[model samples]
Target: MISAVFWDFGGVFTGSPFHLDDYARSLGTTNERLLEHVFGRYEANGDHPWHRLERGEGTLAEALEAADESCRADGIEGFSAEGFFKAMSGTSSEERRDKVMAKVSELNDAAIRQAIITNNAKEFGDIWRSLIPVDELFEAVIDSSAVGIRKPDSAIYRLALERLEVSRPETSVFLDDFEPNVAAARNLGMHGILVGEDIVPALRELDRILGNDGV
Candidate 1:
C-alpha cells in the first residue's frame, strides 16, 4: 500500500524555467560546449561550482564568478552567471497548475502523505516556495541546498522516506521530470512516475498505482 507521494519541483511542478539551448544561444556557443564549460565533467553531481553552490558550500556570487571565469577561458568573452540565472528565473509562470494541485488536495484528503524533493539553488527558495502551499499541501520539503544532498542520490531519497515515516520504499510513489532522478527512485524500490509536458497522464497513473481514482 502506497502511503506517501514524493514530488519534484522545477520542471515537474511548473513549466521548465531553464533551457540549455536558450542559454547557449544567449552566450553564442553550442549547448554541449556551454554545458561542459559551466557544469564541468559530472554536470549535476560533480565537484563543479554548480554542485558546490547547490550543496550550500558557496554563495551564489562566488559560483557566478567562477562560471564567468570559465566562460572567459572558453572564449565566450563576457558571460554573466547572474544574468543567466535571472533569465532562467524569468521563464517561470506565476500561474500554478490547478489540475495537479487539485489532485494533490485529493491525495491529502485521502490521508496519504506528500512531500517535495528538489535539487534547487538556495537563493531561489523563496520563488519556488511561493509556488505551492507547503504547509497545507505537503508534510515535508526536502531541498538539496538545505540538506546538502541532491536527487539521483540514494541518501536524499532515504531522507525523504525517513521524514515521511515510510519504512518501506514500496509504500511510496515518486514523480519527477528528470529520467535519472526517476530511475534512482525506482532503484530504491519506490514506484516512479515520469512527469512530462502534460502531467494529467502521470497523475492518473499515480492514481491507478494507488488503487483509487479518488486519490
Candidate 2:
C-alpha cells in the first residue's frame, strides 16, 4: 500500500502552460538549438541554468549573468536575460486544475497520505498559504527554492520521505510533470508517475495504481 503520495506543483496540480516553441521564438533561436543549449546532456548535473531559476533560488539578474557568461563562452553575443524572463513570465498559470490543498484534502479523506514536492519560489508559497492552509494539506512540502536545491536531486527526495516518516520506497509514490524528474524518483526506488499530458489522466492513473495496491 502506498503510505505517502507526492505531487508536483506545476502541471500536476496547476495548469502551467510553458511552451518551448514560444520561448525559442521569443529568443529568436530555433527550438532544437535552444534545447541543446539549455538542456544539454549535462542537465542531470543541475547544469541547466533556466531550470534552476524556475526553482526560485537565484534572482533573474543572477540567471542573466550566468546566461551572459555562457553566451560569451560559446562565442555568441547579445543574449538578453530581460528578454528571456519576459517570455518566461508570459507563460501564465493553468486555470483548469483544482488547487493542491483541495486535492490533498480529498486524498486525506480517502485515508491516503499526501504531500507536495515542487520547484516553486518560496515567496509564492507564502502567498499560497494566504489562500489556503498549505501546511494542513500535505504531511510535508519540499520546495527546492526554499531549500537551495532542485529536483532530479536525490537529497530532496530523501528529505521528503524522511519528513513523511516513510522509510521504504514501496510505501510512497511521486507524481511529477517532467519525465526526468519522475526518473529521479524512480532511480531512488520510489514509484513515479510522469504527468506530461492532462493531469486528470495522471490523477486517475494514480487512483488505479494505489487502489490496486490497497492504499
Candidate 3:
C-alpha cells in the first residue's frame, strides 16, 4: 500500500512560480530572454540561486542583490529579483489552492505519512508556513534548498523516501506540476502524478495505489 504522499509546492500547491510571460513582459523582452537571464545557465544544471533562497541561506532581497551582481557581471541591466518575487508572490489571495490544502489536512492520519517535496529557495518554508500551518499538515517537508539538491535529482527523491521511512518506492505517490520532476519520481519506482485543475481523479488514483500498497 502507498505509505506516503509527496507533494510539490509551486504549481501544485499554488500556481506556476512566476509566470514566464509576466516576467518577459516586465523585462520588455520575450519569454526566452527571461528564461535565459534568470535560469538558462547554471552549474551542474542545479538551481543555485533558488536553492539558496529556499534553504534559508538568504533573504529575497539578498538573493535579488546577488542576482543584480550577476547581471552586472554579464553586462545585463535592470533585471529585478524584487519585481520577479513580487510577481511570483502575486497576492497569496486567490482561493485556488484551498481544496488541495484542505485535502492534505483531511488525509492527516497514521495510515499515510504526508510530505512536501519541493525545489524552493531559502525562506520558502517560512513563507509557506506563514501562509498555512504546513508543519501541522505535513509529516515531513524536503525543501531542495535545505537538502542541497533539487528534484529531477534521484538523491532528493531518495531523501523523501528515507524521511517517510518507506523503503519501497511503490509505497509512495509523488505529485508535482512539472513533467520532468514527475518523470524522475516514476524512474525512482514511485507512482507519480502531474497535478492540474482536474485533480479529483488523481486523488482517487492515489487511493487506488494506496489500496494496493496495503495501507
Candidate 4:
C-alpha cells in the first residue's frame, strides 16, 4: 500500500512562473544563447550557479554576478538576473490547479501523507509559499535551500522520507516534472511518476497505484 505521495513544486503544483524561452525572447536573445551564457547548458547539475543558489551555498546577488561574468565571457553582455526574474515573477500569478489540490485532499482524507520537495532558490521562499495553502495542503514542505540539498540528490529524498517517518521506500510514490529527480527517487526504491504538461494522467496513475480507480 502506498502511504505517502511526494510532489514537486514549480511545475507540478503551479505553472512554471518563468518560461526560459519567453524570457529570453523578451531580452532579444534566444533560449539557447541565454542558457549557454547563464547556466552553461539546459540541464545543469550540482556545479551550476543556480544549483549553488538552490543549495543555499551562495546568495542570489553572488549567483547573478557569476552569471553576468559567464555571459560576458561568452561575449554576450547585458545579462541581468534581477530584470529577468522580476519580469518572470510578474508574469506569474498564484493560479493553483484545483484538480491536483483535490487529489491531494483526497489522499490526505484517506490517511495518506503528502509532502512537497522542491529545488528552489532561498530568496523565493515567500513568493512560492504564497502560491499555495502549503500548511493545509501538505504535511511537509522541503525546500532545497532550507535543507542544503537539492533534487536528483538521493540524500534529500532520504531526508524527506525520514522526516515523514516512512521507512519503506516502496510504499511511497514520488512525482516530479524533471526526469532526473524521478529517476533518483526510483533509484532509492520509490515508485516514480513523471508529471508532464498535463497532470491529470499522472494523478490518475498515482491513484491507480494507490488502488483507487475512482479517485
Candidate 5:
C-alpha cells in the first residue's frame, strides 16, 4: 500500500508552466533546448540562474537577467521571462483540479500522508497558495526556495520523505509533470507517475496504484 503521496504543484495541480514552448518555437528552437538554457539540465543540480531562483539564492530579477543574457547569447530573440510566466496557467481544468483535490482529501481522511514538493520561487509563494487550499490539503509543502534545494536533487526528496516519516521509500509515490523529477523519485525507490498535458489518465493511474480504482 502507498503510505504517502507526493505532488508537484505546477504541472500536477495547475496547468504546466512549461507550455511556454511557443516562445521556444518563436526563437527557432525546441522547447527542450530553450528550457535547458533557462532551467538547465533539470536532471542535475547546477548554478543556473533559474536554479538559484528556485533555491532562494537569487532574486527573480537577477535570474531573469541572467536567463535573458543566455538567450541573447544563443540568438533566441525576444526572450521575456515575465511573458513566459504569464502563460503558465494557475489551474489545469477546474473539474480536474477538483478531482485531484477530492482524492487528496480522501487520502488525508484515510491517514495516508501527503506533501507538496514544488520547485517554485519565493516571489510567487502567495500567488500559488491562493490557487489552492494548500495548508488544508497538505501536511507539509517543501518549496525549493524555502529549503535552498530543488527537485532532481536527491537531498530535497530525502528531506520530504524525512518530514513525511516515510521510512520505506517504496511505500511512497510521487507525481509530477516533469519526467526527470519523476525519474529522480523512482531512483530513490518511490513509485513515480509522470503527468502529461492531460492529467485525467494520470489520475486514473494513481488510483490504480493505490488500489482506489472504481471508487
Candidate 6:
C-alpha cells in the first residue's frame, strides 16, 4: 500500500556529502576530526554553523569561517570549506549511484511516485543538481535551504508529504543515511530505511517494502 518513496540525495544517491578521508588526510587529520569540526553533532539539528547553513540562516562563507575558527581554537587549523568541497565535488558525477538509480527507475515505471528531500546548503544546489538528473528522476526535489526547514524537524517532512498529496504518511517510505532523520520519519508514522556505507541492504529493504504492488 505504499503510495510514494522519499529519498535523501547525499548519502543515499551519491557519495557522502564530501570526500572525508581524502580531505582529512590533506589536512593531516583524521576523518572523524574533520567531520566533527566541520559538521558538528549532525545527528541533532542544533545551533552549529553547518546546521545553520543548511537551514538557510547563514552563507557558506560564514559557515566555513566558523569551521576555521573552531579549528584554530583547538590549535588545529587549515580547514577550508571551499577547498574541501571543491575537491570532493570533483569526484561527483552521474552514474555514481547506478543501483539506486535503477531502483528509482523501477519505481517510476511502476507509477510509484518519488521525491528527494535533502538537508543541503543553498550554495550547493547547482553543483549537486547537475550531478543528478533531478528533474527527470524525481517529481519533487525538496532542499532544506530553499524551504528554510531542515531534517529531523517534522515540519519539513510534513511539507514534503503535503506536496506529494499523501493522505497517509504511513503509506510512504523514506530513506536516509542519518539515523536521526530516519527515526524522525518513523516517529511520524512513515516507513524509514537507514542507509549505511553499503547501499544494497537499504535498497533491498525498500524493495521489500514496495514489493510488486506498484502502488
What C-alpha lDDT, on a 0 to 100 scale, does residue 84 get in candidate 4? 66
lDDT of 3 by residue, 1-215 (tens): 66688998877667665356766576566655565555434223444554456545656666567667765566656787677767667733446568677778666754578999987766556776676678888988898778877777888899999998989997788988777888999999999988764556666776677667676
Greater-lDDT candidate between 2 and 6 = 6
List, residue by residue over 70-95, the lDDT tens digit for candidate 2.
Answer: 65576555567565545544543444
Each model's backbone clash number: 0, 1, 10, 0, 0, 0
Which residue pairs collide, candidate 6?
A: none
TM-score, every prediction? 0.85, 0.75, 0.78, 0.84, 0.91, 0.89
Best by TM-score: 5
Better of 4 and 5 by TM-score: 5
**Residue 7, candidate 6: how far off, in angstroms?**
0.4
The 10-residue segment of model 5 with minimum total lDDT is 83-92
Write out the backbone clash pairs for model 2: 15-94
> Which residues of candidate 2, in runs, are more than 4 Å off?
16-18, 35-42, 46-58, 68-94, 99-102, 121-133
- What 10-residue stretch in candidate 4 is worst by lDDT? 87-96
Estimate, for each residue in 100-179, the C-alpha lDDT of model 6 and write its tens digit. Answer: 88999989998889999999999889987876689999999889999988998999899999989998999999999888
How many collisions between residues are there in candidate 6? 0
Lowest summed-lDDT stretch of 10 residues in model 2?
91-100
Per-residue lDDT for 6-35 in model 4, tens only?
A: 999877876543346776776667876776
Per-residue lDDT tens digits for candidate 1, residues 1-215, read 78999998876678644345677787888766765666565326877887777777767777777878888887896577666766556555544466678888998988999999988788988887787787789999999899999778889999999999999998899998778889999999999998876777888789799995243
Stretches of candidate 5 off by over 4 Å are: 212-215
Q: Write the per-residue lDDT of candidate 5 for residues 13-122, one digit (tens) a residue.
A: 88886666766777787787777777777667777888888999989889888878888898888878666676565336787688789989999998899999999999
Predicted structure 4, TM vs. truth:
0.84
The deviation in Å at residue 213 for candidate 1 is 10
